[model samples]
Target: MQKPLLVTDFLDRARRYYGDHEAVVATTGERFTYDEFGERADGFAAALAERGIEKGDRVGVLDPNTHYHLEAAYGAMQLGAVHTPLNYRLTPDDFEYILSDAGVDAVFADYEYAEKIEAVRDDVPTEVFVTNDADAVEGDWESFDEAIETDAGFERPEMAEDDVITINYTSGTTGDPKGVCRTHRTETLHAYLVALHLDISDDDVYLWTLPMFHVNGWGHIYAVTGMGAKHVCTRGIDAGGIFEAVAAEDVSYLCGAPTVLNLLVDYYGDHGDVPTTGDNDVRVATAGSAPPEAVIRAVEDDFGWYLSHVYGATETGPLITTSDARRFFDDGSSARFGVKKRQGIGFLGTEVRVVDEDGNDVPQDDATLGEIVVRGNQVMDRYWNKPEETEIAFSDRIEGYYHTGDLATVDSDGMIAIRDRKKDIIISGGENISTIELEDTLYEHDAVADAAVIPAPSDEWGETPKAFIVPASGDPEAPGTTEEEIVDFTREHLASYKVVRRVEFVESLPTTATGKVQKYELRQEEWDDEDRMVGEG
Candidate 1:
């Protein structure tokens, strides 16, 4: 009676067990059942087969978080074709690089992002183009909806657990972005790990706060669907819209980055009387940035939502570690709540260790600094079409482990605390300034909505810390928020070298597709004239 472990098998099971259960709710007030979802996925699979899509073909999807995206992703998996979700916000050149890099054979895009594909369609080798909107269709493009109107369902391809299912492109902080190919085996296991950590169940109504393009939407698309849980899709991250959806859709669980959590807390503070449909509390799982202790405490105390923190990168299936305070904080003390802000221990299926330069494990005393390395089934299969880079990534400077390029320390209690990115640490005036540390302190300020700390060149010091801020609600154009105020805030909490030397107010911090603040981009402008790419770590 054991069922197959493939993603398609999960979809079919959901259809049978929860056939009449609602699956996806769109912002436009449209809803689909598990049965309807399976039918649409099957229809799309047949449509792709009709268009000559076969096993191993690379199909790129460029769309926002929509019901169609889920259908297309599962459909491609059914055909054994690799589903590559492109970030719709990428520039034209970035899109061109990825399309050509992956050698995508077909592209399924939303009408809003069709123009980006059209601009580089000739440069890339994509042959077939499918768009969601008929009115925006251009030359040689087919209607995505019309193509799937046929009643016949395509036969599921014979797929092994190890077959590659998705290719996720890295954010490319240093140079060109690398395509990280993930196998079905890894994806399936990662989903289980996430679901187990978050305690997902059939009654949980999950929301799509994270983009589907980012690590398979933190793998909830499979984990939630595998449990036959309902998915509430949000078109975008608007404060009012998310609140309304959470209450109206009866959302019980959601995953987001620290930025998303910050926005939610800000929204709830400004607009009181937000209502929830059910008695069960909403649980939020956040990552991407190490959330400030203040934000974590606020989400738990003010909003009355249970909060969990996790840490991982794109190459690690993005769920290698989680911080579950409940297991350790049974005493329910405020100090235990503060400990929840740490990245915590590795997930069940992963092995994490802090190693020195010689690849030796660091002491568990919590003071010894070392690189956080990981090995797991969730690790990416390889960098697509780049064997040399793949080898470098897997077996480069560190030997067997996949170098996370992040610095951390493990406490005696086995909790892992992230210090900073290997490249984000600044050495100025013979002292080290962790940009992450400085930024975390700055975020505790009441007026700061978001903060990014980068290294700026200085005449006296090799490099100094510079803070870029997004004001919480104050007017940037009018007279508000002096640099001295922020400097004073940082000084009260940090050492002299760690204090921000320069401050620039901006509307928003530049973020990667996965919601990580792209600190390298900010450092680029400062280090443009410098000879070296970066100072010694």
Candidate 2:
């Protein structure tokens, strides 16, 4: 009974016992049972194997939330190959860098995003390019449907527990992205933790609101499939589409960022109302920065769907703490929203602590700021091809804990509240924007003398990046770099979401004696009288 923990075990269970259960609902108006999904997954693996996919080969998946994406994940893992997820929101340069860096042997992309891969396909090391729509793709690529339709048998390879399963790239402190390597053991344990904390069961129907590329949808693919729950996959995040899915599929649970919640709340304000009991007891888990208390209230009170706020990063399996307030407080009380706002205790098997600079515990006075650190089976193994970053992440001053780079405070009731992000990261619309990357891009402009980037409050997005620029001592606004010019330069170099929203021309940036930019000074000025700190909450 002491076999190596493999991720395929979850899908195996579903195929073996829950063969007749409705497993997947695709946006293409097709449905499949557990047995059918498993057979399709094996077919995908067999197709890739025929095209020279072998153990340890890196496979990249670039698609929106779809049943095909889930099949790609399980298929890649089943063959002992590392499944690498590429962010479709990134620019062509980013795609090239990640694909080339990860040594991706093959890539499976959707129609809308496959063209990005085409932009950099010549330079990358990818051997096979497969797309969901072969007709839509202009270049040489294989058809996903044709591959899965084959009957070639797939041989399950022997994989160890510590074998790398997924490579999730993140915009870390450095200007370039870092690939966080997650092992089969890490994913298996993280899925179990998700099942326990989210209370997932076979009876629940999960709607695909979150992107499948994000930490493998926070590891719900394995957990939901293992439970034999039905999956309703969506292509996009429009409010109308979400409501339709909720009503059509009887969706019981889903996850998204505060931005998604804002859309739903805004849509209901104009169109009509949100259905709660008509479908199922809809429960939602929101992450990528906290949601405003008003939105939390609207989801719980107005719509009747329970809201739970969880917090974590790509390195920590993206799920460490949750704020299911009703479990600890009154259910229908007015103060429930306030209690639900706090990032509650760590999930099962996860160890979370807020500590000061010296690695000492911060007092639970609810006012002191400390960095949140985590250590558990759900944590990542290392950063691929970056030994220094891996060493720094594991060799935290606190020892045995991965630093989250988020500042928060714990209350007396053991509820944690985030105050600021220490990593200079802007979680705008659930996407991480690295300020260092933005500043480095600004430095490329000749008219820019110095620059600093910080998060600014936004109503729609959780937060947006605001750049403080010191022009190269020319005309204040006439000759040198105008705000428009700087913005244009950033758009050409960086992704659309990472572009600076607001630009301010400053005389001089506040700097330390060692010539370090004091970003906190700008942060304090920006968030002077904001209601909620990060983005909305």
Clashes per candidate (backbone, < 3 Å): 0, 1
For model 2, name the residue pairs that clash.
Answer: 462-535
Residue by residue across 225-278, what tens digits does model 1's lDDT show?
Answer: 989999888776887777777777778898878888877878887888766334
lDDT of each: 0.83, 0.84
Task: Name the regions of candidate 2 deviating beyond 4 angstroms.
Answer: 171-174, 274-277, 325-327, 423-537
Q: Which ten residues in a row have the lowest lDDT in candidate 2?
A: 509-518
Estimate, for each residue in 1-537, the C-alpha lDDT of model 2 and write its tens digit.
Answer: 688878999999999889998999989989999999998889899999999999899999998888889889888889999999877777889989999899999999998889999999999999898889999888998999898888787788889999999999874333577899999899999999899889999989999888788888899989999989999998868888898788878899998776678668777777875554445889999875556666787788778898888888889997999887566778878777767767788887788999999999899998787889999899999999999888888667588899987788899877888766675668988886767568767867878756788999888886898999877664456438677888889999989998998899887776422123567778778988886556842
- C-alpha TM-scores of all predictions: 0.95, 0.80
In model 1, the Cα lDDT at residue 68 comes to 83
TM-score, model 2 to reference: 0.80
